[model samples]
Target: MSRHGTAARLSFYYAALFTAVGAHMPFWPLWLKDKGLGATDIGLIMAATYLTKIMVGPAAGHLVDRHGDRRHPMSLLAAGATLVWLLFSLVDGFGPILAVTVLAVGLWSGIFPLGESLAMMETQRHRLDYGRVRLWGSLTFIASAIATGSLLTRQPSAVMVWVVAAALGLTALACWCLPTSVAAGRGKAPATPLWPLLKHPVFLAFLATTSVGTASHTVYYAFATIHWQAAGIDGDTIGLLWAEGVIAEVVLFAFSGWVVGKLGPGRLLIIATCAGMVRWLGLGMFTAIPALAAFQLLHAATFGCAHLGAMHFIARAVPPTLSARAQGMLSAVAMGAAPGLMSPLAGRLYESLGSSAFFVMTGLSLVGAGLALFLARRWDGGTIV
Candidate 1:
């Protein structure tokens, strides 16, 4: 496939996928609340979903690596996710919702690492700018958040699941639009076990850095919308607040190549940790519009830079044949286990301390900064295995 064609397909997949995410991430807690679940219950449900990613990601990676295909598996997973979300309309209480969400997220989580592996492969082969293509997802995310937030104003929170289900259906279709195949040797056994990568000091540091940095957002992701709403910020404004962070993220992705070149992954991760510390601290102490707006912009550095750093690190440090697996491990640690473990604690903290829960997140950023420093010192800017 032509580079432009491949980029377009990947962009469509991202856009479709994140359209569901943009709605689900900010407002799903609201939906749970509307269904009469408390903050702790919402926290448990969110944590369960996050934890499922740990198992699903690596297992899916192993499957894709063996078959040397991502598109088909991604489509199947998307279809499963859509079906699960549609089933949500039938489930009313916390236990049923939790069970369905865990299943849905397990299937849904696998798609991201596979898609990222494909995107990075294209970046290497075709000189495709990963950031430019990824920006489309961020843009769609902004639009979805704003639109869904507006919808919630007139419609009930029950509308959230259906919108996400529709988006997931589009995502399944988009997966078929991806380039027909990856470069892996189809039907070949993986040459090495994942154990070496698991035990490697540098890889461990890399995980700790990205995982802690990303986990710093657990409290915010679980409670920010609810907190803002409780403070009389209104759903539309809360949507705008979410949009503002991703707008910054989109801008960063648009210029990611330049930034990645200038700073490298290590420095980028460090920057993310620093930005996260400041952002979380500010969020904990203030609820005023100006303070909230200013802190949200730091998301560019916190999430945008951290993600760019991890992707580039994997692209540079890991072999092509192992790309999907590496991406899965990264996702499992950074987005899965760390955040999964943190969510319940974050829920309890948010319930008891309200906005003060952000203070705990700031400490996570500090730990991530220290790990990033270690990674920068140990890594020689070359492939690890």
Candidate 2:
């Protein structure tokens, strides 16, 4: 295929994948509440989804590396995800819903990391810019989130399942169009086990920094709308708030190439970690303040910059063949395990400590910033590749 054709196909895949997340993330918890789940029950169910991803992502990564055919596993999993969602639409209780979520998310979550591996592989093959191509996903995420949020305001919570299912089905279709050449040929290089990598100081630092930085967002993800509602913000206003953060994220992605070039990955990480400290503090304490408009803008750095830094770190730190594994490991650590473990804690802390949970997150972000600074010294002084 021509380079332009390849890029177009990959961009479509990203749009579909991110749209799937946009459908689920903002609305899923609300749907659970609609089903009569309490706050703690909602948090537990969501945590279960992340827990499944942590357990399943590495195994899926290993399979992709072993079989050397990204298409087969990815397609099968996407199909399974679609089926799981279809099943979920029928279930009414916490037990059935949680069971389906675990099954569906365990398979559904693997699609992105594997798709990313394919995108990077194509970028390497065609000398295309990975950031430029990858940014499309961020754009799609914002667009879809806004559209879905608006739809929810007019429609029932049941619509969320249909939106999610449709997105996953489209994702599977996009996966089918991925370049067959890159899809085949599982390299014979022995799989580097995750344990040894976890033991490495640099990797541990990366894990810790990412865990703390991302954990800061857990409260916002799990309870932002609820908190805002309690504070007298209307549902529509809460949706706007969430959309605004994503819009800022989209803008950051649009400029990611220049941003990465000017600041470098390590410095960007430090900035993101610092921004996390400010963001959680703002949300935890000053969310009711009109000045929150200014603080919410920091989402660009907190999520956008942090994710960009992590992607670059994985790209630079690991070889191309192991890129899938590295991304998988990062997702499992940062998104899966860290959030899975920290989210419930954040919920509990919010119950007893109230907004002081932000102070805890603030301290964690400071630690992450310090670690990023150390990594800057370690990685900046040396050749990253």
User: Candidate 1 — which residues are off by over 4 angstroms?
Assistant: 184-186
Return the TM-score for each candidate structure: 0.98, 0.92
Q: What is the C-alpha lDDT profile of model 1 across 247-303, one tens digit per residue?
A: 999999999989999999999999999898999999999999999999999999999
lDDT by residue (1-385, candidate 2, tens digit) is 8999989988888888888887788778889888998777787887887777686777776766665677777788888898788887789888998898888998898886787777777876887777778777777777777787788779998889989999999888888888864333345643554456656677677777887788777777877766776787765666667777877887887777788778877888899999988888888877664656677788899988888888777766766546677767777878788888877787777667766777888888898899888877766433233
- Predicted model with the maximum lDDT: 1
Which stretch of 10 consecutive residues in model 1 shows the poorest summed lDDT?
Answer: 180-189
- TM-score, cand. 2 vs. native: 0.92
- Global lDDT of each candidate: 0.90, 0.78
Instruction: Report how far off residue 212 is in candidate 1 (Å).
Output: 0.7
